[model samples]
Target: MTTPTSSTVLVPRIRGALAHSDRIVLPQSVLEQLLSEAGRESLPSPLTFRVFNPATNAYTHCGVREFSAPESTVLISPQIASTLGVSEKQLQASSTQDGSTPPVLLVSKCDLPKGTFVSLCPLDTNYLTMDDNWKALLESALQASYTTLTEGQTFSIVNPATREAITLLVNNLQPEKAVCIVETDLTVDITAMSEDHAWKSVAHRDAKRKVESGKVATISQDAPVRGTFSDLSQVFLFDLKSWDRSRPVIVELEVLDAGDSSERDIDGRAADVFVSIDEHPSKDYFLWSTQTDEKNVISIAPSNSFLATAEKITLAVRSCVVPLSFSLMVSQEEGIVEQKSAPAPQSESRQCPNCKQLFPPRTFQLHTAFCERNNLLCPHLGCGRIFRRQDGIPASHWHCDLDSFSCDSVSTKEKHILAHHTLATCVCGESFPSQQHLAHHRATICPQKLHICRFCHLRLPQESRDSQSDLLAGYTGHEFRCGTRTTDCPRCNRIVKLRDLDSHMQLHELQRVSAPLPRICANALCVRVIDDDPAAANSNSLGLCSSCFGPLYSPMHDPTGARLKGRIERRYFIQLTTGCKRSYCTNPACVTGRTNSNLPKLAPAEVAAMVKELTEGGKLEFCVDDGMTRRRRLVNWIGDDNEFARPWICRAVGEVRVGGEDDDPTSSEAKARSWLVENGVRITEVR
Candidate 1:
């Protein structure tokens, strides 16, 4: 086996000969064309080959095949060609018949599957040399297709001869996964003089050991440690389990300059230091100045250790000092010492010349001058004392010493003569020579009196007399007096005095009565009597008496005429009977009863007219003597009376014919009454 020499493969022009088709066949001519194209291009070893089928608009997989140099016609394996649906002849013919040249076929290149081999092809050629440009074009086309495919995509290849296209599809394409990397640094510092100095270093070493041991290290404080720093720093923290560094926590410190005051006081000085740490980075540190001024001397615990630590840690302290200077002088000659003796004590007491009160000598003398100017005398009235003047003793300063009145002359003492005896009389006529006596008189000697009214038992000042009559007039002769003095007696018709009227009426056997009881008239008119009757008090016509029954059947007045006394209560009854004959109540309780001897006799003409109307079915009646029968008739009339008759009468007369063909010469009584009313007879006053 000799090594084949390299030669360029030429790419054939793809034209109408291999136009796209919906049902593509991989002919042996097409396979040979691919192999020839690969050899002529002198493509690199392990090159990719692809083929597209217009028939499914998809690429199909073909196995890798080795290329052997320039003029050799490449042949595809029978298995691969069969898988590709091509014949051996077609594969061989795809290469050149000329010894130095390569055969070609124009065919759609979309037949290969993604990442699968289709056919061997050269990487170099006229077209292949322009791979950069073509690659860009292909990428743009692929991007466009991919974008379209991603957005409701459908793909197809056009068959030039049939003018039809086949479709291809891919559901989804996996994207490339990403990996990210981040870096950080952390820094740390240690101050050996801090109280946790050894612990801090141990913690740091332990943390490192933990990292090496693949155990996670957490910086939880056993006790919080406070410290100070002068510059900015960075801190690092590491995750020992992962051995990964976290981002650096940066801390910045502010610089402070102490002025020229040199007394450094460190009492109660404090600060806070922040430290940050991260894995894969350094640690950062910062200082905060929290120091406070020392106000007073304060003793701190474990002073020696604290001072030593403070000195080593460069802590600021204030210095305070008080400076002093001294000088001394000495006299020449004898170096001597001196001694002295004690003085004797003196008595100190004096009495005031005025009151004889004892006091210290110095105080007494000082008070004496003031006492003399203000005339301070003894308050004892019996002594009648007066203070003596500094110049001459006054006579009033002498006091009486004798027991008898005539011999009780004032006597002089060493201080002064007692004078001006107190008087026994007080302004209020009480005697008191002293305030104590006067107070006793006021308490036991004053008099007071109060006066009261005798009648009403009301209290009043002794000086007021105006209320006497009002208090005296409350008595009444009777237990209850009558309230009516202006009203007349119903029986005697006399006005009774309010106070004596009840007793005066009792003399006449008249109890102070209310108005006499009301009674219905026994007359035919049945009038009601509201006035009191002395006669009815003794007699009975069912308590109505004789006067009301006398005028029953009188022709002088209409028997049915409404008596004024009765109509007072029967106005509406009268109005209902406007055109009808007046009604007569013949009940024995009425004045028109049969027993009334003064009943007036009616005329024969009147009796005949009433009898005619009564027989003609009109409402007319005459008083009769039958008591029970008359009562029954009165009750029936009251029951049967239609109070709606007046309006009926008005309607009948309103249709009456006057001087007309249908006129009646005989007028009805209603028409006569209407004529009378029209001729100025007052209907309301008719009696």
Candidate 2:
């Protein structure tokens, strides 16, 4: 953090107004005297500086960028004033106010250190004679154009498709001696300033990949050949190698010189010329492709599956724009030939109005003078092909007077007029017109595109930019804060959020399949339930309400319900011969609400034979209310019988509300003894 606040300034070279020579600018009162001598209020993140100069005593470092230069001057970049030898006529005689104290430099406030390895060296070898991948485009253009590296300082960069400047040379940094590449990551390397420039940059990148491995070649099966396309020959290959793994070859292709008319360019590049075949020329290994309109033909199939376990297929092809010509061939499929019902003699032929082919009337006058003087033919209209007049034509075949297209190369009509009339832009500031409409607006709907997130799985930018409550719930602000996390709800344990837990478990599976059912307490020994009070008291037969059949209420009119089955057999013969002595009766056919009082107490003729065998099969369910039969047999023997006594039985026969309480004018017995206290139905009561 070396900040003793030094200043001195005046190096001011600034040619082409700075776009990073490792940045500089300064002088707004020397950044307010180095932010008030470093107690700092603003200028820091990557604020560096250092500079030095004393007439080639050389020094460098840099960073800052814009304090609006002039006062004691600084400005820099003419490659940081030619790396400190500073003297564009001594910065134009110190910006002439008839004054001359110029080349001073020494600027201060440094910090430096963060470099983690650098190296660099190019100084020519045009990024090793560029075929692209120029060391990952010079490490993403030195991390998007430098912030400070220094060592021996050289810098340049350019080459956006051969604008060609290149330069480089920093050569070695690691832990210090001028480093701070702002937010560090460095590791670069590249090397070669001598070993005869690393053997002429690996012999000019192995003689342009040995002329791109002598343009692919191999091809065999049925012969047919012919080819073209050039900007260093856009792809081509061929191979196949003796197949026969149980027959199937095919392969085809036809075009024969086609280009300009399938119209495209605004960066989607086309203008007719197409060709494609694949097994890897990299459209991510696409397979068959064609496109030169008016039927240009293309094929592949030998049961493709990478040609049934490829030991050799290769093909490739590729194209897009160039002096496109084609033909190829391959053939194979045969085995299985028998039908000889005789009918063979046909080979008469004629056709050739200049390479239309079909010859034989005894070599139709020597194949029309060797196809009109070594073939040529193509005058465009439905383009037939031929070409070979010693391969000359394509120097700049034109067409597009703004989209009429054709273009064989003046660098494909200046890349089809800079991809369809120049405009471009988009790293997401969006502008378009070409580069194929900013690559179809960054591959369709570019809200800064990128994507991945699906709830913070991270890659980002599908742009809904969160919080206005996830942009009003349409989400994408990193999946609305990764759907605010939360969770629980495996069907209502309730916590929720993970993006509204799938509409909160789809509203609990739509209220568990449209809810309804649980009306309960028709007293199969009553574990309550009923009160959804639209003025309570549901009319009853024994769907009991009036306090569970109001102690067998009697304003009796019977209507052959055999007097309500003799009042439910006299309330189970008074709860089995005198024992409603209720201790919150847990009725196991109630003797004294039997909690197993050591059996044997029956006697009065076994209490009329246990009340005629517990009221025979008339199924008179034993009378309820002893605190709802001990809370319905303690929730049918302790809980969850389908979440609390589902259809509880132990002595059935239910329906017993004969005829009174005016057929339930909101029946009473204290509103059915607190109709399960407004039907909230939880259990716990037995005290």
Which candidate has the top score in TM-score? 2
lDDT of model 2 at residue 561? 72
Q: What pairs collide in candidate 2? A: 260-406, 266-436, 267-435, 267-436, 268-436, 400-405, 466-477, 541-657, 547-672
Q: Give the winner by lDDT.
A: 2
Ten residues in sequence with the least summed lDDT for candidate 1: 176-185
**lDDT, model 2, position 212:** 45
Per-residue lDDT of candidate 1, residues 336-450 (tens digit): 2222453333456676776655677768878887766755564545453444445343333333353211111121121111111333443335555533344333322221111
Q: Report the C-alpha lDDT of model 2 over 38-85, residue by residue, as the tens digit.
A: 574565687777777776788877787678866766677788777777
lDDT score for residue 481 of model 1: 22
* RMSD per model, one decimal: 54.6, 22.7
Q: Report the alpha-carbon TM-score of model 1 versus the true structure.
A: 0.12
**Cα distance off (Å), candidate 1, residue 603:** 25
Model 1 vs truth, CA RMSD: 54.6
